[model samples]
Target: MKSNNEKNPGISRRTFLYSLGALALSGCDGGISAPVTPGSRATSRVSTSGITLAHVANGAADVATSGAFAHPGLLHTQADFDRMAQKVAAQASPWYDCWNVLIANSHARLSWSPRPQVEVDRGGSGAQNYPVLYGDIAAAYASALRWKITGDTAYADKAVQIMNAWSSTLQILGGDSNVDLAAGIYGYEFANAGEIMRGYSGWAAADFAAFQTMMRDIFYPINVDFLNRHNNTDITHYWANWDLCNMASIMAIGVLCDDHTLFDQAVNYYIDGAGNGAIAQAVYYMHPGYLGQWQETGRDQGHNTLGIALGGAICEMAWNQGIDLYGYDNNRFLAGAEYVAKSNLVQADGTYLTVPYVSYTNVDVTQPGFSTASQGTIRPCWALVYNHYVNRKGLAAPWSTKFALAIQPEGGGGNYGTASGGFDQLGYGTLTCTRDAVTPATAPSGLTAFPSAGQVVLSWWGVAGGTSYNVKRASSSGGSYTTVASGIADPLTYTDNPSAGTWYYVVSAQTATGESSNSAEVVAVTALQLHTYLTFDEASGTSAADATGNGHTGTLIGGATRAAGHSRNAVSLDGSSGYVSLPGNVVADISDFTIAAWVFWNGGNAWARIFDFGAGTGRYLFLTPKSSSGLMRFAITTNGGHGERAINGNVALPTGQWAHVAVTLSGTTATLYLNGNVIGGSTDMVFAPWRVGPAAQNWIGRSQYSGDPYFHGSIDDFRIYRGAMSTDQITALVQGS
Candidate 1:
């Protein structure tokens, strides 16, 4: 096993000395490594006494000395240590020292910029220098662990030097200065630094205690002050790219200090829209390479994974401290791990595949792809490691093992090889496993003889050693097909929900080696209508029974002459009845359905029922009448409830002139068109086939059940369709010459 200290060469004595000199020169103004006097104030100090540093150190030392272990603090037995040491010894080289350089540079920056008042871009524009405070803290702790394991005074001295620098320079600013100090609380940059420092405190109890006091008194309070002020506010714009970093850092610090106020505030910010509402929001707000931007770019999976991984790490740290992150519950994190493992990792059979992104067409399944050689191969490996801890600690889920297997690298060649150099040394290993030839299967036979309802089942044969399957469907021959379901390992079958119409299905099988072969195609039929149609006829009915009752059954009373009625109730062309009761009782069974009515009224009233079911539950299509315009109004009740749509102007009803009105419901959207022009539209909950009949009748002139106002206008021809008509279709119907 490679020891963290030994594997990272940047931690050499020379580098340590250089970092110390940098810290000393940066400012000895009671900032870096200044010994604390009894009366001196402390701020942003981190203590390590409570952490299990000894165990961590022993674990690290065990790996370094043995050289055969794979990870530090993971091996349970001495034998396991011996086995991992061999692997490390064979792979160890000077290049491993780069990690140390990173550590040193990171520490030096942390120590000098304890509270960075200004940004420093190290050679690049917009790139801020490492916030060395946390880096120094991490270095000190890592060095202390190294010292405990190897009894190396060099490591101990380095740790002491870093700690002393932090003790003196750590400043707790209040009042106006609090702003400057609080700016340093950028979470991503500082939380890891604090964790590192805290890790080191394990070596010396008194120093750790002092560090804890400094963190509690200085660092934590400033963070609390800033967060309290910005809580539930849109101040995310102020921090710009580092918003998540800042938020996560605050939460981590709050957890460290056990400050419920800050912690709860952060949690509410994330889960309750105070923080970035979704990962996408974070990505959208930041520039590329910024904390959120890296994930958003999507080109470099490694970098994107790092952002998510850091989030996971911080989540774990918070969880360990008893903080509840809203969306990142153990199950969700475990689910993410499962996704990465099953989709992205190279399997043991030498085939690499993973779900790199979510498919826009199908939000459920992750799109799979083979990894490129240029990217860092360690990402999935790291995810696996973190997931392992979560699983082993019983903190995540039992499915973690399954997820781990999905991402575990295949043991043979072409995999990530053990090497000891920089960039060039990171290429793929020798190819040991031969790539399998993939051939697309013929379209499935017996497609025309499928079921008409329930689950649409599709099946195929001939795929051997297959690990999973993907299913695609299209409406017409040679049309575009989309993946509807995936990741099925057995039974060689899939069942799709029945819809109204004929549909086609196709299946593809993926091998354990990551090769995929498409299967033959199949088609199924459904009873539900897939389209809606509409038309308006000026003459139809007058009273509740006449408007909804089939054609001749409707009452032809008074000025409700079909021609006169054309300006009001429109017409019910289909044999289906159109009924209107007082208060508003009306219903219609619509697959893809359209409602056209001519209404004429000029009055201000509440609960003006344009159309609704007698029961007043489930779906409702109604209108809200405004004092300004007797123009027109509409609403839809899908999913479970209802909402309204009202027109902008008050075009007085042309007394006797016929006017057209139509509402169309298709898929999950409902649109209201007046005289062929789109007036309003809204997204419905989901698509459901509604049933309308005598009890569930359609109201034409007034609302029957509840009283507010009744329609006083002519009636006309009303037509309903089995499908939703397009705007063009609706326009033609409303404007027929």
Candidate 2:
């Protein structure tokens, strides 16, 4: 194996060993080498035009070198590198365990299983190989970098042995021409070797160049050609493509080797196609494989994890090349990392749950067929290690720290229980946190009330730990309360604006941690009670049936047209027929209520009219032509109140079409019905109140003030309510109809 630290020509292994021993004897600091200042050649800015791209390359190098920054690595300090190395070191034992499973399974020919071919099994059972190599190479380089920083011979020797074994295998595999066989046997192994060597110093320029050439000239072309030839665009399953991992691995190597063309093409294809956004789109278009799978099972876990990881890698590559194809800020890789951390690592209990599938979908209801223990351990181990690296490099958020702490096993067996691959006693010894309780700092001594300017104001002491407050108000002593304002996190005061009524108000406090408790209810009142006024007949004594007063009433007569001089009388309160018309038009007060009435036709071909303007003021309520059915309508123009309903059962009125009709308005909702059944209803509306004046006049068997759809019917028993009447009330009114 090549030593990255030696000065080539004169530095022998013995001299190198002696120098390191001397440094160790001197008790020199061994954690991290001091970071070079900006002016230093090793740390100088690569290029201003493509700063983003340069930073990405630097990030890749940092990842490759166990987070070191002696030369190619940038955007991280010595402390950052040391922290990353420490995390990688801690995972060495676990990596060994997991990798041994792959090594055993691979040697046992499990990779050659025929039931599910290798390509299809790559994610399912064959996933072990790649993760193992990735872990090994990462651990090796990280350990070597640690030794470089600390003058530790043991670390250096171990790194060299690992590298020697890794490099020998790479050389043997690179010599093979059977591309499929080579990749199947050692594809991940090659990626791992290339990644580790990427962090090595340029002093071994010849060996590095040779290794780079082999990867580019042989491995890359063979794999790229194989992938392109076998491309299966029809497969909707994301991981089914053999090139997903291969493309990522090749891109990483190509970027490091400065193969610009390969790098560009890799980026274009992956980001524009197999990248993060692409996977999300695919998932949206194609529902999860298992029905309600997201709710029940963890089947989608592997795809989500792989897509996110690959997305992060591609983003890093694009960032390093100064190409923001995704249109986000220059920190595309960091964005991907944050997204993965938030979606996968963090849990509702404020602890990191290891199952990525659990975070992707609601799973408490649908347990996946796989062993819960496997789901828990595998996901958490992968996520925490990845997150630990991201956090140490300062690429993650503060919230990720909580996730890291949660996934660690309480007594050291691992975070998701005993790690025995069973769910019998899961979540035991886990650290979980819940929303904090809240308590008011001050209690109210007495409730205060005030009424002024048609609005009520109430004030109270501020409560501690409350992020929001809710206020409710009601009319009458024990009426139901209505919400005035909620989730208002402000000074402890509220105001109530109600229509014409005295009301009581109450408040509740809510906290940032989602805790809410009611505060003492307060009382308040407004000065004036506003009333709706109804205008009827103007007080005039007799028969002129004043054509210029605000109220008037009458009966309909004559067929098609009124008899020339046979005057019809307006019925009075005492039922007298002495031309007893009110002086003005009739107006009914219905602040929030239902109105019902009946009309009877006298011999007339014209439809009977119920509501009519004194003059032709463009407002009237009457039935259409008899051939057009006994349909009746009500129209008012004070504020544009309009409603219509018709009898549609084929029930004809005697001679002329005269029938019963009703219109109801209840809090923005209005209904129109004929006889008894409702025909149509309108929601979210306001029927303007009607007004009558002294100049208004009423007419019998004709429009009170105009021509055409005139009433040839007798009108009687018109009533109104001050509030909304129930269906039963309307039903009884219909019986009278």
Off by over 4 Å in 2: 1-79, 82-139, 148-154, 168-203, 217-219, 222-244, 274-298, 316-402, 408-737
User: lDDT of all predictions, in order shown?
Assistant: 0.36, 0.35
**Range of the 10 consecutive residues with the lowest summed lDDT in candidate 2:** 31-40
Candidate 1 yields a Cα-based lDDT of 0.36
**Number of backbone collisions per candidate:** 92, 25
lDDT digits (tens) for residues 612-689 of candidate 2? 433222222322324244544443331111112122323444433444555665544666656665755556333222
TM-score of 1: 0.40
Best by lDDT: 1
Cα RMSD to native, each candidate?
20.1, 25.4
